[model samples]
Target: MNIGVIKETKTDETRVALQPFQVKVLIANGHKIYVENNAGVLAGFPDDEYVVNGAEIKDKKYILDKCKLILKIKAPLDNEYNDYTKDHIIFTYLHFDENILPDKIRELIKSGFMGIAYEWVEESGRYPLLEPMSKLTGYLFAQKAVEFCTKYKGIICGKHEDYLKGANVLIIGLGTIGLSSLKFCMDNNLKISVLDKNLATVNIRINERFKTNKIDYIEKYSIELISFNNSDPLKTKAELEKTINKYDIILNCAVRRPDMPKDKLEYLIDRQMIQTMEPYSVICDTTACDNDLIETCVSSEEVDKIDIINDVVHYSCDHLPSIVGKSATELLTSQTFPFILEIANKGISEAVKSNKALYRGVVCYKNKITHRYIAEKKGFQFYKLSDLV
Candidate 1:
C-alpha cells in the first residue's frame, strides 16, 4: 500500500495528518509513504525527520498521482479537488455537517471516490477521531474566552487577572467539548451551569465516572445542572433567558443545526437571545462554522476577527486545534493511525466490510452516499455501506 501525506493549505492550518513516527511505523509495516516536502515542517517535523524514518519526500503532483491513500488534516481545499479520483482514498476531517456540502464534496461523490470522514468514525457510540480535537478545542475555548473577556472588560469588573474567580459560565452541551471546557472553568474557579437535554444521562454518567475514578475533571469540578426540553427550542430559550443574563460567558458546544439555504440562518444563540446578555459578554462556539450557534458570528473568514453585535462579543473560528499545531498533529495521528493501518492492510472495500467503526466513517464510497445524515441533508440516494458490503 502506498500512503501520501499532504500539507494543509487552509488559512492558519498548521497541523499535518501524519507525523514522522507514524510514517516510520507504516514504512516498517511494508507500506510505502510519500510525504510532501515541508508537509510536517509546520508541525515541527522537518524533511530530515521523514527521511530518517524511511518516508520518501515527494512533490505534490507525484503524491496525488501515485498514492493509494491520501492523508490530510483538514478536508481538501477547492483547488485540490482535481487531485482525487476513484482509485484514491481520502482520509481526513471531512466535516460535512459543519456547513453546507461544497461542490467539491459533491464532485468527489459523483466521481465514485472513497471518503472516510474522521468525525463520523464512531466506536461504541463515541467519536474516536473527533475526541482528541474536541479536547484541544475545549482548552482553546477557555483561552479564547479569557482573552476576549478581559480585553473587552466583559466578565470581570475588577482586576483583569482575577476575572475568572466567581465568573458565571453557561455550557450548552455535556459532550467531550463541554466536559473539557468545564475542566478549564473549574481550574479558574468559575461557577458553571450546564444545560443539556439529557440532564439525567449527564448526571448519571458523571456520577458513575467520578465514583469509578474514571475522570479527574469530574472529581475536581462542582457543577450546577439545568435540564431543558431539547426538542422545544422556544421553550428552552425562554427557560434559558430567565437565567442567561447572569452568565458572563456562554460556551456553545452542542451539535449544530443541519445545513440550510444560505439566506435562511437558523441560530442556536440568536440576536434576540444575546439581547439578554450583559454588555461585553462573550459567546465562544467550539462547534464554529457558520452562524449556527453564535448568530452574530460572521464566518471567521469573512470578518477575520470577533464581531460585536448586540453588545456581545462572538468568536467562531472553526480550526481551533490547529493553533497548537505540533501537539494536535501528534494527538490526531496517534488516534487515527490504527484505522489508517486497517484500511491499508485490508484495502478499502475489505476494511469497511470487516471494521464496523471504519465502515461508520465512510461518507461516500463507489458513487453511493453511505452516511445517512449526509445523504438526508444533501438529497442523495442513501445506501448503507453494511448492506452494500
Candidate 2:
C-alpha cells in the first residue's frame, strides 16, 4: 500500500494529516509512506524528522501521482481537483454539507475518487476523529469569550468576590464541545447554564458525572438546565428572550444539518434577541457556520477579527483547531492513524466492507455518492456502498 501525506492548502490550516512518528509506524507495517515536502512543518514536524523516520519526502505532484491513498487535514482545493484519479482514496475532513461550493462537489463526483470524511468516521455513535478538534474548539471558544468580555466591555469574565456577580455563560449544547466549554467556564468561576435539544440526555450525563464525584463544581454552583423547542426557532427565540439579556456570554455548540429545510433552519438567536443583550456581550458559535444558530454570525471570521452586531461581539471561527496546530495535529493523528492503517493493510474495498465506521465515513465510493445526506442535499443520485461493493 502506498500512502501520501499532502500539505494542507487551506488558508490558516497548519495541521498535517500524519506526524513523523505516525509515518514511521506506517513504514514499519510494510507500507510505503510518501510525505509532501514541508507537509508537517507547520505542525512542528519537519521534513528531516520524516526522513529520519523512513518516510520519503517528495513534492506534491509526485505524491498525488504515485500514491493511491491520500491523507490530508482538509479537503482538496480547486487547484488540486484535477490531480485526483478514480483509484485515489482521499481521507480528510470533507465538509460537503457546510458552505462547500457546488462546483467543488460536482468536481469530486466527476473525479470518482473515494472520499472518507474524518468527521463522519464514528464509533459507538461518537465521532472519535472529530472529538479532539471539537474539544480544542471549545477551549478556544471559552478563551475568546473571556478576551472579548474584558477587551470590549471592560469587565472580568471570571467571578471575583469584589464584584457583585460574575459573568453569566449560557452553553447551548451539552455535546463534547459544550461539556468541555462548561469545564473551562467552571474552572474560571463563571456562572454557567446549559441547554440542549435533548434535556433527558443532558440530565443523564449530569447525574452520571455527579454520582462519580467528578464534577464538584456542579455541587458548588447551581447549573441551570434551560429547555427550548428545537423544531420551532421562533418559539425558541421567544423563550430565550426572557433571560437572554442576563447572559454575559453565550457559547453555541449546537449543530444544524445542512440538509434541513430553510424554514426549519431559523436562527436560535435572532437579531431582535441580540438587540436585547447588553453591549459588548460575547457570543461564540463553536459550530461556526453562516446563518447557523446565531443569526448575527453571518459568516465564520478569523480568530483576531470578530463581528459586532447590535453591540454584541460574535466569535465564530470554522477552523479553530488549526490555530493550535501542534496539539491539534498530534491529537488528530492519534485517532486517525489507526483508520489509515486499516485501509492501508486491508485495502479500501476490504476495509470499508469490514469496518462499519469506515464505511459510514465514505461520502463517495466507486464514483457515486455513498452518503445519503450529502447526495440529497446536493441533488445527486445516491448509491449504497454495499450495492457497489
Candidate 3:
C-alpha cells in the first residue's frame, strides 16, 4: 500500500497528519510512504527527519496522482478538488457540515472517493481520535484567553493571586473542551463560571468534582454553574445576555455540525447576545465552525485586527491546536495511526466492512452518502454502508 501525506493548504493551518516517527512505523510495516516536500516542516518535523525515517519526499502532484491513501490535517481546499480522484481514500478532519466549506468539496464527496473524518470515527460511544485533540483544544482555550487578555488589557493572565487578581472566566458547554477549561481555572484558582445545556450532566459532573482534588481549594462562590438546555434558542440567548456582562473572558465550547437546520443549530451567543458582554472581554471559540455559536466569530486567518463587534473581542480560531503544532501533531498521529494502518493494510472497503469504528468515520463511498447525518441534511438518498457492503 502506498500512503501519502500532504502539506495542509488551509489558511493558518500548521499541523501535519503524519509525523516522522509514524512514517517510520508505517514503513516498517511494509507500506510505502510518500510525503509532500515540507509537509511536516511547520509541525517541527523537517524533511531530513522524514527521509531518515524511510519516507520518500515527493511533490504534491505525484502524491495526489499515485498514492492510494491520502492523509491530511484539514479537508481538501477548493483548489485541490481537481487533484483528487475516485481512487483516492482521503482521511482527515473533513468538517463536511461546516456551512462555510467550499461547494466543490460537497460535489467531490458525492463523487465516490472515500472520505473519512477523524472526528467522526467512534468506538463504544466515544470519539477516540477527537478526544485527544478536544482535550488539548479545551486546555489551550485557557492559554488563548491569557494571551488575548494581556494583549487588550495590559494585564497578564496567570494563576498567581496578584497577577490576574480580578479576571473572571465563563465557559459555555461542559463537554471535553469545557471541562478542560474548568480544570485550568481550578488549577490556577481563577474565578470561573460554567454554563451547560444539559442540567443532568452539569449536576453529575459537578458532584463528581467534589471527589477530585482539583477544585477543593477554590472558593465555592468563585466557581459557579449556570444551567440551561437547547429546548429554546431564544431563551438561551436571553439567558446568556443576562450574565455575559459579568465575565472578562469567555470560552465557548459549543459544537454545531452542518446537518442541523438553521433553527435547530445552537447559537447560544449570537451577535445580539455578544453585544451585551463587557468591553475588552474575549470570546475564545474552541469549536470554530461557520455560523458559529458565537455569531461574530472569525477564522484564525482573519483575526489579525481587533474585531470589535459591540466593543467585545471575537477570537475564533478553527484549528487552535495547530498553534501548538508539535504537541498537536504528535497527539493526532498517535490517535490516527492505527486507523491509517487498518486502511493501508486491509484496503478501504474491507476495513470499513470489518471495523465498526472505521465504518462510522466514512461519510461517502460509491457515489453515495454512507453517513446518515450528511445524507439527511443534504436531502440526498441515504445508503447504509452495511447494506451496500
Candidate 4:
C-alpha cells in the first residue's frame, strides 16, 4: 500500500494529516509512506523528521501521482482537483455538509475517488476523529470569548466578589464543544447558565460529572438550565428575550442539521435579539456557517477577526482548531492513524466492508454518492456501498 500525506492548502490551515511518528509506524507495518515536501512543517514536524522516520519526502505532484491513498487535513482545493483520479482515495475533513461548495462536491464525484470524511467516521455513537478537534475548538473559543470581551467591551470577566461585577455567560448546547466552554467559564468564576433542547438530560449529566465527592468547586455552584425548542422558534425567541440582555457573553455550539430545509431554518438569535444585548457584549458561534445559530455569524472571517453587528462583537471563526496547529495535528493524527493503517493493510474495499465506522465515513465511493445525508443535501443520487462494491 502506498499512502501520501499532502500539505493543507486551505487559508490559515496549518495542521497535517499524519505526524512523523505515525509515518514511522505505517512504514514499519510494511506500508510505503510518501509525505509532500514541507507538509508537516507548519505543525512543527519538518520534512527532515519524516525522512528520518522512513517516509519519502516528495513534492505534491509526485506524491499525488504515485500514491493511491491520500491523507489530508482539508479537502483538495480547486487547483488540486485535476490531479485526482478514480484510483485515488481521499481521507480528510471533506465538510460536504457546509464548508465545501457545490462545484467541489461535483468535482469529487466526477473524479470517482473514494472520499472518506474524517468528521463522519463514528464509533459507539461518537465521532472519534472529530471529537479531539471539537474539544480543542471549544477550548480556543472560550479563550477567544474572554479576550474579545476584555478588548472590545473593556471589562474583565471574573467573579463579582473579587471584581467589580462578574460577567454572565450563556452556553448554548451541551455537546463536547459546549461542555468544554462551560468548564473554562466555571474555572474563571463567571456566572454560567446553559441552554439545550433537553434540559433534564443536561442537568443529569452535569450533576453526574460534577459530583460533590469528585469536584468541590462546582458542588455549590448552581447553574441555571434553559430549555430551547428549535421547532418552535417563536416560542424560543420569546423565552430568550426575557434574559438575553443579561448575559455578557453567549457561546453557540449547537450544530444545525445539514439536511434541514433552508426555508424551515430559523435563527436562534436574530438581529432584534442581538439588539437587546448590552453594547460591546460578545457572541461566539463555534458552529459557524452562513445561516448559523447566530444570525450575524458568517464563516468568512479569518482566525480572530471580530465582526461588530449592532455594537455587539461577534466572533465566529470556522477553523478554530487550525489556529492551534501543533496541538490539533498531534491530537487529530493520533485518532486517524489507526483508520489509515486499516485501509493501508486491508485495502480500501476490504477495509470499508469490514469496518462499519470507515464505511459510514465514505461520502463518495465507486463513482457514486454513498452518504445519505450528503446525497440528499446535495441533490445527488445516493448508492449504498454494498451495492457499489
Candidate 5:
C-alpha cells in the first residue's frame, strides 16, 4: 500500500497523522509512504527526517493523488477537497456526525473510498488513534474554559489568573473526555458538579467504595456534588439552569450528536436562558459535534444570536492537540504505531474484522453503510460484517 501523509489544512492543525518513526515501522513492513514536504514540521518531524526514515518526500498534491491510503489529522478544507480522489483510504478523527465534515469529505465518501475513523475504532475499550488527542482536548478544554469564564464576574480564583480556586464548574459526562477535564479541573481545586445520563454510572460515582478514592476527591465528592441523568430534559434543564447560574464555569463534556432535538432543545434553551448571569460566564464543550457551539458564533442581517452570550467560548472546534505542537506529534505516534502495523502487514479487512477499526464504504458488500453512527446519520442500517466476510 502506498500510504500518504499530508500537512493538515484545517486551521490551527499542527498535528500530523504519521510521525517519522511510525513511518519507518510501516516502511519496514514493505509499505511505501509518501509524505508532503514539511508535513510533520509542526510536530517536530522535519521533511529531512522523513527522507532519512525512508519515506518519499513528495508535494501535497502529488501524494494525495497517488497514495493508496491516506492519514490526516483533520478533515480537508475546501481547496484540498477539490483534489481528493476515490481510491484512497483516509484515516483520522473525522467528526462526521457533527456535520462539520467538509464538502471534500462528502466527495470522498461518495467516491467509494475506504474510510477508517480513528475515533470510532475501539480496542479493549481504548480508542486507538484518538485517545491521546481526546485526553489533551479534555485537559485543554478546562484551561480554556477558565480563560473564557474570566469574562464573567466573580469567578473564584485564589491568587492569579489561570488559577481557579473555588468556583462551581460542571462537567457533564464521565467518558474519556469528561474524566480528562475532571482531572485538570480537580487539580485546580475547584468545586465540580458532574452529570451523565446513566443511572448505573451515577451509582459508580457516589458509591464511596468506588476505588481510587484514596487519591482523588473529585471521585469521592462526585456522588455528593449533585449529579443527574437525562431522564427529564425539562427538569434536567431547570436543574442545570440553576447550576449554570450558580457556577462560575460550565464545561460540557458530553459527546452527543446535536441533531435529534432541535426544537425541543431550542425551546429548553429559551426557558433556561440566563443572560443576567453576568457577561463573564464561560461555556465550553469538548464534544465533537458542537453545532450549538458553532451556532453561538454567528450573526446575520435579519436575525442573529451574535451578542447573546458574551465571554462564552467553544473549545477550538478545530483539533486542539495540534496547538500543543510536538507534544501532539509524539502523541500521534503513540496512537498510529499500532494501527499502521496492522494495516501494513495484515490489511484493513483484518483490522476492521477485529472490531478495532471503522470502515467507510461497501460495509456489507450488500451495498449499505456499515458503521453504526454513519448508518444512523445516512439513514442506513448496520449490515452484517459476516456478509462482507
Candidate 6:
C-alpha cells in the first residue's frame, strides 16, 4: 500500500506532516511513501534528507488520489484534494472550535474517506495517541500563564537574569494536559495550588504519575477544593473569598465552559476580596472556548478591569497546540508514528484486528461515539468503530 505525504499549506504552519526520519521508518517496513517537494523544510528536514531516506518526491495527484492512506497534520483543503472515497483513510488533527463546523472539517467528513482524528482518539479514552500534544499545550499554557498573572497583578516573580521563581499556579484538572502543566510549573520552582472535584479518581489516575504532589505546590503555596462535574457551584461567598490572594495564576486546562456559572464568576470578581492583590492576578482559562467557560469568566467582560488593577493575559492563547510547532510535531510524531507504521505494514485489515488505534468514523467498533461533542455539533450518528471491527 502506498502512503502519501502532502505539503502543509496552512498559513504560518512551520511543522511538516512527515519528517525525514519518520519516512524512513515506513520505507524500512516495505511500504511505499510519496512526499510532496519540500514538505519538511520548516521542521529542519532538507530535501536531501528525504531522498536519502528513500521517499519519492512526487506530484500531489498520485500521492492524494492513488495512495490508500494519507497522512497530514492539517485538514485537507477540499479544493486541492481528489475525490474522497470510502476506501481511503485520512489521518489528521481535525480541530473542532465552534458551533459552526469549519468548511475544512465538514468537507473531510463529507469526503467520506474513513476519517481518523488523532485528537478524537482521546474522546473514547481507549486509545490515546494524541495525549502528548494535549500535554504540550497544557505545559506551555502553564508557563505562559504565570507570566500573564504576574505582569497583570503587578507582582515581580523573577529577576532579569533569572528564571521565573516562586509563582503561584493553579492547575484545574489531572489529565495529561493538566499533569504536564503541573510538572512544568514545578520544574520552574513555582508554588502550585491544585483544585479538582474528584480527589479519588484524580489521585488514582494522576497521583502516581505526578508523584502524589511530590512536586510540592504546598510548602510555598496554597491549595483549594472545588467541584465541577457533579455539583452546582458552591455558594461559598466566604470560603472562596478566603482563597483570593492565596493564588496568583489560575491555569484552567479542564473542559471548556463558554460561560461559567454566574455564582462562579461572582466569586472571582468581588472587589474587596480579590482586587487587593498587586493587580496582575490573572486567569488563563484554556476552557474559554466553551460557552460555559467564556460566558462565566469576568476577565473577558473587562480585560481592562484586571489591567487597571495590574492582572492581564499578556499573550494571545488558544487550544491550537500547533503554536509550539516543532515540539508539538516531534511529540505527536513519536507517539502516533508507531500505529501508522503498523497500519502500513499489515494493511487496515490485519492492522486493526487487535490494535486499538483503528477507528472508523466517530464510532468505535464497540458501537459508541468516540467524540460525543462532535456528534452534538452536526447531528451525525456515531457508530462504535470497535463494534464494527
| RMSD each, Å | 3.6, 2.3, 3.0, 2.3, 5.1, 5.9
Candidate 1 local distance difference test against the native? 0.79
- Please, what is the whole-model Cα lDDT of each candidate in the order they appear? 0.79, 0.84, 0.78, 0.84, 0.62, 0.59
lDDT of 5 by residue, 65-118 (tens): 788778887665556555555556677666555554434345545655555666
lDDT of 4 by residue, 1-389 (tens): 99999988788889999988888888888999999988989999999999999999999888989999999987777777777898999999888887677667887668788899999998989899999998888888988998889888888887857546878899998888987887788878788888888875664655554453334333455678787776775677688888999998999998876543445656778888999999999998898777566788887537868889999999888888998899999999889999999999999899999999999999887678899988877778889988887
TM-score of 4: 0.93
TM-score of each: 0.88, 0.92, 0.89, 0.93, 0.80, 0.73
Model 4 clash pairs are none
Between 5 and 6, whose TM-score is larger? 5
Tens digit of per-residue lDDT, candidate 1, span 146-172: 678778854452222643355678888
Give per-candidate clash totals: 0, 0, 1, 0, 3, 46
lDDT of model 1 at position 252 = 87
**In model 6, how many backbone clashes occur?**
46
Candidate 3 error regions (>4 Å): 156-159, 162-164, 199-221, 256-266, 301-306, 387-389
lDDT string, candidate 3, 1-389, tens digits: 99999998887678999988888888888999999999989889999999999999999999988898999988776677667778888999877656544355466665568888898899999898988888888888787786777788666555576544657888888788887887777666667887776754564565464455443333554567677655566676677788888888888887764543467755667787777777788887778765567777765643233466787877776777877888999998898999998888888889998999999998877677788876665566778887766
Error of 2 at 116 (Å): 0.5
